[model samples]
Target: MDNFWFNQSDYEYEVVEPCTYQNNHSVELLVGQYVHSIICILGFVGNSLVIVTYAFYKRTKSMTDVYLLNVAIADLLFVVSLPIIVYNKLSSWSMGPVACKLLHGSYSVNLYSGMLLLACISTDRYIAIVQARRSFRLRSLPRSRLICAIVWTFAFLLSVPTFYFYNWYEPLHTQDVYMYDGHEKNLTTPQFVCEFRFTNNSTAWTTKVAVPSTQLAVGFFLPLLIMTVCYTAIIVKLLSVRNFQRHKAVRVVMAVVVVFVACHLPYNIVLFYDTVIMFQHQMCEASDALQVAKTVTQTIAYLHCCLNPVLYAFVGVKFRNHFRSIIQDLWCLGKRYIAPRRFSRVASEVFVSTRRSVDGSSDNGSSLTM
Candidate 1:
């Protein structure tokens, strides 16, 4: 949502006239706010479940799962910041400077960390599948942890500049600001809008031009290129295999790529366009339309945080059993309908033995472990 805030005043206009840039879209504003609340709640619950699943339930995990655990950690952190975003949309920012920077910077860190992690997952999958029966160097758990640490470090460093740009700025002219209408546009409202500001010509080139340029390049374009190369090569190798199951690991790979392109690409495109327009200092009359588009696309982008659990984790055969076990345990309802039936005697005996051994379950009680 912070990425979608393209304040019209953030852009310079050479032609001056008695212009009234009031957002008369009350219905759209209400709908966007409703979507904001829904995404906040759903993303929080979904990502929290992901963290719980990986932390307390799953005992053994692959290298891909390790990356996913860090991804879930990033999403959970970002989901907690959703209230800040909703508050910005619904009211003026009253929280102090530290809170503003922390909230906005966390959003930036999420953007950078999530994409980089997904790219890492794709690369790992490509190696595991395409390089089947071959040995690779960085395939161990230690290396996986090191990769995650590096990603977290890089993500925090990437957001360091955001602390400089995002600050509470008083309204110089309410008419030109074009704040979110959900703020009510009170004529007597005396509050600061926490946002990224260029301040003057000296900082404009760096804040407006450079920051967004770097964001689009590293946050979107570079990840897009990496994902494209990895997934394409992976698909080629899968097609050549004689016994590759179409509905197995392959479907999960396709889902990841499809979800990424669908949810995040439009927002990134709008961001890239905004950066270019700012650098060119062009004046456009379609600011209202562009604002609505950006808001909608960014809201759609929030779906990715919720969908990561379903698309990546729930799609796995092993995770499905773990999810069912957790749900059954939470409700105190035994798994009578959701679990798959084991036909062979040996398989059923193994399932019962493993379930009891893994979670220390008794005839009466069970733990969260799986």
Candidate 2:
């Protein structure tokens, strides 16, 4: 939740330049735990619904739908881990090194994968609209699938370091933790918490400087750059078109760009600030301020996972229709099973996918691009 390896602490750290905050952390801790729990539940359900609706209930799909399906899958993968992160942050990491490695790796993979998929979606949209008459070789569905595979493979490879560095270390002081037995008891003991560390100085340098810098650039900035350019070009092209709903297309493009920047920019800014502080060895009150800022901003970014479905549900007409169909089918199913053993009236027909015109209008799925 707090980036890949960064965690907040209420007490001063011994070997790490005494990175402690002067403010009372009780509010932050209490709010963070519950918010994480709530977001975990909502994000899981939202992402799962997106995937299920697109995968099963929708019989028709454009190239945009394929990209969105993968996006939903990636978000769901990360959403399921929020509860574990909540437990780890509220309590300590009790799941051992294997669990820590898996969680960290999954987080990194999910982060980069979602960003890359958004970039891909934007590029696909650019090709679909701006280069609608050109770039014939790149618009095929099979090509889109190949591009997605490449994106996933690249994201997974970039995140492999998280698996390697997620090792445990013993804290210098004893921690008071609760134990489960016949009855609950609190006891003091030396505990191990999850952290990213390396023995060799060179490896440490790479982990601290190179890996995160690359993540900051490729995972956050690059996708942002891609979307900005793509949407700008899309807007220009939309202006030139005299027919159809060009204004709607431009508004949708702008909305995608705005939502992405709104959700992700704050966290990246704080992350960059944290990196600068760490690299500069600035152990001052500013460090305390940045620590708090980082925690707050990271929470904002975590909301992005669930926000995707909400954004789509509002903007995409076909997505809303598909969701309505699913709800109606569910209601009819519930009425059939619970209200009576036999059908009292003719069953209502449920349409899985929304109908499209002969011109292959993509107003349904185009709103999904970041």
- Give the alpha carbon lDDT tens digit for every residue of 54-168 in model 1: 7766753467778888888888787788767667645678887788888999889998898899888878877776775552554677888989899989988988889778887
Worst 10 residues of 1 by lDDT: 361-370
> In candidate 2, what are the lDDT values of residues 1-370, reduced to their tens digit?
5657644675657664455565525535855678776778888888888887766666324566777788888889887876776567556678888888898889889899989988887887788777767646666678778888998889889988888887866664444556687664647654677878788988887688767787889998999999899889989988888855777767777777788888789988878866766657665677677777877777778888888776644367666766766676677767767765564343333222222221143444343332
**All candidates: TM-score:** 0.78, 0.82
User: Root-mean-square deviation of each candidate, in angstroms?
Assistant: 10.9, 9.4
The regions of model 2 sitting more than 4 angstroms off are 1-17, 20-28, 173-187, 242-244, 312-314, 342-345, 348-370
lDDT (CA) per prediction: 0.71, 0.73
- Most accurate candidate by TM-score: 2
